[model samples]
Target: MTPYTPPTQDQLLAISVNAGIEELTQSEKFAHAESDLVEAIVEGVGQFAAGEFAPLNRIGDLEGAKLENGVVRLPDGFKEAYDAYVEQGWNAIASPEEFGGQGLPFTLSCNVLENLGAANMAFNLLPMLSVGAIEALEHHGSKDQQTKYLPDLVSGKWSGTMNLTEPAAGSDVGALRSTAVPIEEGEHAGKYKIAGQKIYITWGEHELAENIIHLVLARLPDAPKGSRGISLFLVPKYHVNDDGSLGNRNDLRCVSLEHKLGINASPTCVMSYGDNDECIGELVGQENRGLLAMFTMMNNARINVGNQGAHIAERATQQALYYAMDRVQSARAGAPDKTPVAIIEHPDVRRMILRMKALTEGVRALLYYCAGQVDRGTIGDGDAKNRAEILVPLVKAWGTDTGVEVTGIGIQIHGGMGFVEETGAAQHWRDSRIAPIYEGTNGIQAADLVTRKLGIEGGEAMIALFDEIARDAAEQPTLLALAKDCAHIVRWMRDEASLDDRLAGSVPFCTMAAVAVAGWQLLKQDKAVSAGAAPALAESKPVSVRFFLDHIVPEAHGLKASAIAGADLLYTLPSDKLVAG
Candidate 1:
């Protein structure tokens, strides 16, 4: 496995030009995140990631996380690496000023996540989950709650997890049967006894932090049914007294840790709360509104999950590029001496490598762009907020899908060696495979795009985005056509398509829309390169953007018909007919 090296030039250009980092820095809220300061932060984080995290990735993958005697243990060096992460305050980069954070733009924080994810994806999960919890608390938790928890969470001295999934309720949060009953009178009055079993909790258990803060979704005894009944609670592993000292252990325990396909070093726990009728927690917000608050966390996480896709793809691309240049293979087509040359010289190999490069860069641009919009949204830009909401699903779904595709291509570039564990090409794929599945599966993201996003401002946000793309691609005919097609699809999904019909085509529509967005973002970089804005990437940027627009953007054309195809055919066959005998 090659040590991860940060693609500083490309990353800087993506965040600066495509994401408009300077524009973000100009905002009063993010004035401190000046371009030079952001650059230095990115550089320092890259070095730290390359040095501390990259070296342990293989070991983390091989050893995975362990659970023994009710204790969850991370891979060797993993604890020290996490301690370093907390000690350096990387986790607090985007947290609020009142919460002991630097209060920098989320754009820079996402860059931090990208670097760490590229270096070691599994190791990144510990903090990634914390990021989500921080958002949830910052937005929904009470002042007392924030005063007690936010400091440690922001400082990374403590960790956090989102416990939403139950064994029976994965995508559907409302189906779970967790219950929280109010305490009428006691020292813990106003709090509730939370009792439920939640599964698939990422980083649910770990010793890296001093405490684990769990954001749980449960229902009040008198709560309404389904999603409307859900309530968010802040449940700590150990009770925290008003004076900030730890008390006895709470009633939650990790009954078991899941055996996963990837990110094995991050424990996915099946947590049982109040097994002995002692798990106590307080409401995060108004009752019956937990879903809304949790979405605050999930939405933030969805974008970062997309970020995971981008960086994991970056990692795979780096390894494959290195391997292609180093591995000796058959001679070139016109080699006179017939000496074995590197496989990178092969035409087919070049094709695959370029695809990986183009897609990785393009997706990364979208990731940063999407995150920058989120920061813009935070600063009271309603239009930007709506746009960020629209872009989240696209970035999450397409970015992860791209990650999967690029990693697979990386394997192909490595030939048989890629399949072997020693080459470490397969680990990237194994790790990325989960990104699209978790964080509201890509299918769900697509469904959100079609069902919800297109309905925003009667589809104005979607239309305006496509219009911007179409306008930018005026000189580029292929990209312009795709952008126009996307606009048309938005209108169709909004005006003509029925709910069932829109859903039937939602996944493909998401792919098409994402391709167009990524294409335009790449075009931004291409134009920047041509205009001398990114002198460092003059030669490579155009090549990558050209490939993406020419080869990748056309993929949207193929998805157009499928995207709007109605649901009739999908329901033509009954459930029994499609079932296995």
Candidate 2:
């Protein structure tokens, strides 16, 4: 077994920037997030990872979570750690300043979240939900509503949940059956009584905080059918008074918690509203526009899910590297028979390890770059905003899909040990599985990319993205050739390719776009590296950027070809031929 040496800070920075991460910090819109701010966030995240969060990960999994008397109880030390998290004001990173938040860039907030996810995913979910609620409220909530609820949520004195999925409506919010009836002029005149069941609510019921604010979607009594009737609401577990203190428990109650395959520490609950005739909800935005309002939160949440995937990949890679270095195996081909070599010495093992490292770092770069885009879109000038909007779907879809693959490789690198639950490798694999499935699944994300984002502003935004990629690629001949190939493929896939044909190769089309986008981002980093940027951060830029372009970018070719191959083979297969009689 060989001693393990952590990658240097400079090396990480170089690889990250080469991956297009530092651009997030340097962008003019994010100028406020100076080096000192980044350092502070990094330091805080590092401390949380090392001291509070990482140590309790195994404990949380081992004990799991329990539902007793309608309340979810976390494993030992979970509450204390959560409190410590709040005490550090980690939850307020992205919240507005008026709401007792730091109002920092999402890029910085995302960096902190990545570390937290890497440390303990279950623990991180509570605050993640709260942030989502905050976004929805900030964007669409009435001024009165925001003033009343935003402070506690931002301060982490309370938590939040999004209630969308039900037994009948998981992916299709339009199929939702929840009802919201306006109250007669009485004690709750301005409110509506919500009656419905929402399933799979993360952090649905927990003892982690004093209250839970639920952002629910329900149809009004006189509303039209389908999604047109749907509306967003703020339903709390406990009502608050004019003074902002907690009041009586609301009508929402957790019937029970789900026993899940993974993320066992984060309570997934079945919530029952209006069971006792007391679930009062405040309408958000206009009636029948709930889904639109929810999109604000969902979009942000989708990106966060991508971050989850990236974080898990990073952790899994670190674990695999550690195991590879320590696990003694057969001697290398050239080594003496008497001496055993570390598994990392095996050519195949090294290859797997390198793939894991490359994928993890590459996805991290993508996630950070996406976060930077988000920051720019929110704070930058008009041009930056346009670019950021164009990149959203690409970031959401590609980051998550790649994350799953990277984590899977992490598991494979562990071999037999990977399958065993005790090794914790399998847990990462299981945890990552859900990212692509939820948050507007990768297929949906791809459809959004091609159908919406590509054509945004008459395709100008996508054109801009391509121009940037081309400009960056011109600096390196190898990458330029690859970029040209990708551009050619994208054009063909969009214009020449048939929808029915592409639908058969839907997965491949998505994969192709992901590959091209990743290559483009890496090329951007390569350009940054050549410009003699931060030395420490530019170190890994050349090698990683080249590795991705040479080895990974070629995948776009296969995907593009498959996408153009037509759907006849898939759709033509008779129903009888597809299944055994």
Highest lDDT against the true fold, candidate: 1
| Model 1 steric clash pairs | none
List model 1 lDDT by residue over 1-581, tens digit each.
99899998898998888778899877799888887888898998999999999998999899989999889988778878888888888998999998899999888889899999999999898889899899999999889989999999999988999999998888889998999999999889889999999999998888888899999999999888999999999999989988988999999999999999888888999999999998999899999999999999999899989998899999999999999999999989987889999999999999999999999998998988888888888899999999999999999999999999999999889999999999999999999999999989998999999978888998988999999999999999989999999899888888898999999999998998888888888888888878887688898888988998889988777888998889999889898999978
Steric overlap count per candidate: 0, 3
Tens digits of lDDT, candidate 2, 1-581: 11112233522453345323355556554456665666667766766765787777777777888987777888788889889888989989878988898877777677767778878777778888888899999999989999999999998889999999999987888999999999989899989999999998999988889899999999998888888889999999889999988899998888988887777788888999999777899999999999999989998888788778777777777888888888898889886675888989999888877776666666666666666667657754566666656556666677777767877887787889888878888877777777777778888877676666656676566655665666766765554555555556456656776766545555665565555556766566566657875466566667766777767766655565676677777767788898976
Each prediction's Cα RMSD? 1.1, 3.0
Error of 1 at 483 (Å): 0.5
Candidate with maximal TM-score: 1
TM-score of each: 0.98, 0.92
